[model samples]
Target: MCGRFALTATLEVLAQMFDVPERPNLAPRWNIAPTQQTCVVTQDPSGRHLASMRWGFEGPNGAPLINARSETAAVKPSFRAALAERRCLVPADSFYEWQHLDEKRKQPWRIGMKGGTPFAFAGLWENATDKAGQPLQRFTILTCAANEYLAPLHERMPVIVAPEDYARWLAPGPAAGDLLRSFPDEPMARYRVSDRVNSVKHDDAGCFERLAATALL
Candidate 1:
């Protein structure tokens, strides 16, 4: 599951890359945890727009829903509605995954495009009312079975939406489901990272630093 990730690009860069209008006040996030507000790209009658939304869906039990399995999302009560009407694109520089080494430890790895270019994760959003009657907007990333490159780290990874399919995905229709497949692993890269990323409190450039090869053993 993609419970943690990073988005260090400036708002200006993101706006240019995603073709959305500039959002000057948007801040760079080195470590994005669940429930934090972040930018997302969506389409409407006017055109594409960049907006901020909380990272997770608030479940009936008050827990955060950060990820939705692509295979079952269309029929899952919590995600079916959003799947059909509120699809979105979640921009990120990279995402973190842990490789289970033993009961006492796990190694973290940073995964991104081969050249470290920015990309978007297929996502879904929803609008709801908080307990106090205030409006709340939130999103969840979709996950599919891992590609060959990522299989060693985990059995699953986030569904990455390609640039060519962005329009079709953001378009309103059931046909967009075809874009939820795993991205090609040949264009992806991964490396061991310092365990500093394991704790949500350590949100900085250090989180992405490569760990010594021996550290993984």
Candidate 2:
């Protein structure tokens, strides 16, 4: 599951890519953890629009659901309506996953498409009320079984929507359900990165630094 990811693209670039007219007020973030405000694009009759939304679902169990298994999300009570009516595009340049090195240890790695291209993850969103009676909009990333190249790092990976299929994914239907499959291993790449990404407090570009160039703490 995508517990942490990065979105470092500029507002202008995201707007053009997603066909959004009004851009949200957001900066380049290199280490985005769950529950934090992150950028999401949703489609309406008026067309696609970019907005900032808090990551994860505010559930009745008092726990935030950050990632949903794409296989079962269509039928899951918490995600069914969102999947059918409130689908969103979670824009990110890359995402972080942990590689199990041994029984007790793991290494952090960064995964992205070749040439480090920007992409969007298939996601679901809904409106909810916060603890203090405040209105809130939240979203959750969709995940599926990992491809051959990513199985070593983790058994699952977020479902990334391609640029060409963005419109179909935003439209609610069985066709959108077909887009939840794993992204091919050919266009994707993974690399060892500094463990600085393990913390929510760090949000700078340094968090994406190659671990081989630096040292992991």
Candidate 3:
């Protein structure tokens, strides 16, 4: 599951990358965790737009789900309707994963595109209402089996949307099922980082920086 990730790019950079005219106030986030607000690009009856919505998936309030497995999202009751009706693309700089070598040993690793281009993660969003009649929008990242590059770091990875496929993924109306496939393995790179990222309290740029030689896991 993608419980934590990073979004450190400036608003101007994201605007240029997404080719959108209006820019929203976006702060750089290095340690984005579940239940936090996140920037998501989605299409409505009007047109395509970017908006901030909560990260964790909360449907009918049994428990918060951070991820929806792409393999079974189409059939699962919790995700089946959303998968077929409401789809969105979540942009992120990179994501974090932990590897376990033994019961007591787990190391955090950072995964990003090779050239550092911002990428989109395929996602499903649901619109639910709170007791106060306030609309609550929640979303979950779609994950597929890890590839050669990410297999060593984790068993699953977000479905990274290719730049060429951005429009198809964000097209209005019915959902796009083909975008749920796993990302190509050759376009990503991963490196070890300090265990400092393991704590949610460490919410700074240092959390994503390369670990020192002596601190390498």
Candidate 4:
């Protein structure tokens, strides 16, 4: 599960990369936690634009489900409708996963595409009401099986939508489901980082401090 992640790209850079005109005054977030509002790219008749959506929607268990398994999202009632029509792209620079070094030794690793280039996670969004009766746009990141490079860390990883497939993914209907495959391991890299990322309070560059040099070849 992509419980914790980061999006450090500037709003100007996100605009250039996504070509979206909506410039919400969002700062660089180095540690985005669940339920926090962040940038999400969604489409409408007006064309693709940026939106600020809180992570996780109300799931069947009455809890905030921030991640969904791509393989079964289509058949799952909680996600079926959104998967069919409300697809979106979640801009993220990197994500974190924990590795079991031993029974009592778990290490946090930051993973992302090589060179820190920004990318989008294939996501599904839904409109729902908050406890106070106000409307809210919430989303859940889709996950697929981990690729060879990241399998040792976890069996699942967020499904990153490639730039070339952005249109196809946001297109109407179930055709977009095919784009949820695990990203290739070659263009990705990972390394040990400070465990401060485990906290929702540590939302700065210090959370990215390197603890080890491990990375993909």
Candidate 5:
């Protein structure tokens, strides 16, 4: 599951990448945890727009819904409605995953495209009220079985929406469901990172610095 990730791209870069007109001043984030606010791209009658929404959804039982499995989301009550109407694209520079090597040893890895290019994850959003009695919009990333490159780290990863499929994903329909599959491993890369990323407080480029071979063990 994609419980933590990062989006350090500039607003201009994201705007161009997602083709949205709004120019919100979004700061770079390196430790985006679940339930925090982040940018998401969605479509409406007006056009595609970039907006901020909380990372997790409030399920019927009031628990945080951070991810929805692509294979079962259509049949899941918490995600079925949003899957049919409120699909979105979650922009990110890279994501973090933890690999357990032993009962007391786990390593955090940074995974991104081979060139560190920005990409979008297939997402779903919903509108609800917050504790402050104000309207709150939230979203959840979709997960699929891991590809070859990520299987060693975890059994699942976020569903990356290709550039060509962005339109179909935001459009209201079931055809876009086909895009929620594992991203190809060839274009992706991963490396072990410092354990500082284990804490949500450390939000900086250092969190992604590649750890030396001797440090990994």
Candidate 6:
């Protein structure tokens, strides 16, 4: 699942990339973690827009972090309603995944679009409110079995959306099943990076620098 990812592109770039108006005060995040406020693009009864959504699915005080499994999201209670009515496009420059190769040598990999174009992740969001009657929103990324290039590192990966399918995925109505497909393997590229990314505090461009395994950490 896309538990952690990067959104280093500018708002204008994202606006053009997603074809939506930028949300004022949208900051660029180098190491976005779950439960944090992150940007998402969606459509509603009014029109398409960009908005910030809390990463982890919000429920009770200790709601689980069960990011919807793309393979079964359409039927799951936590995501069914949102899947049908509140789909979104989660744009990311790249995502990190770790592979446990040996007892002490777990390697981290950064995956991005082949030519560095940003990609969209299929997501579901819900409108929830707190006891104080304040409005709150939460969302989760959908994941599916990993592609050949990623299977060796992790068994699953986020469902990356294709450019042509963006509108259909965010379009109002029954389009979940069709938009839930996995990204084509050809357009994806992967490589190893410094393990500094292993720490959430190490949020910088250096964290994304490619490095030899011997020099990592």
Instruction: Kindly report which residue stretches of model 3 are placed more than 4 angstroms away from their true locations once superposed.
Output: 59-61, 130-133, 214-217
Candidate 1 lDDT, tens digit per residue, 64-173?
99999999999999999999999999999899999999999899898888777889999999997677999988999999999888888899999999888888989887
**86-113: candidate 5 lDDT, tens digit per residue:** 8999999899999998999999999898
Which candidate do you rate higher for lDDT, 1 or 3? 1
Q: Which is the winner by TM-score between candidate 2 and candidate 6? A: 2
Cand. 6 TM to true fold: 0.90
Judge candidate 3 at residue 119 and give its lDDT: 83
- Pick by TM-score: 1 or 6, better one: 1
After superposing candidate 6, which stretches have Cα over 4 Å from the reference?
Answer: 59-66, 130-133, 213-217
User: Which stretches of candidate 4 lie above 4 Å from their native place?
Assistant: 212-217
- Global CA lDDT of candidate 4, please? 0.90
- TM-scores across all candidates? 0.94, 0.95, 0.91, 0.96, 0.96, 0.90
* Candidate 6: Cα lDDT at 5: 93
**Candidate 5 versus the native: TM-score?**
0.96
lDDT of 2 by residue, 1-217 (tens): 8999999989888988999998667889999998899989998888888878999997668788999999999889999989888999999999999988899978999889888789999999999877899998999999999989898889999999989999898885653778899998888877898778988999999988887764321
Candidate 2 — what's its lDDT?
Answer: 0.89
Per-residue lDDT value at 215 in model 3: 31
State the displacement of the C-alpha of residue 7, model 3, in Å, after optimal TM-score superposition: 0.7
TM-score of 3: 0.91
lDDT of each: 0.87, 0.89, 0.81, 0.90, 0.91, 0.81
**What is the Å distance of residue 164 in model 3 from its true position?**
1.1
Among residues 3 or more apart in sequence or in different chains, the pairs in candidate 6 whose N, CA or C atoms overlap within 3 Å are: none
**Candidate 5 lDDT (Cα, whole model)?**
0.91
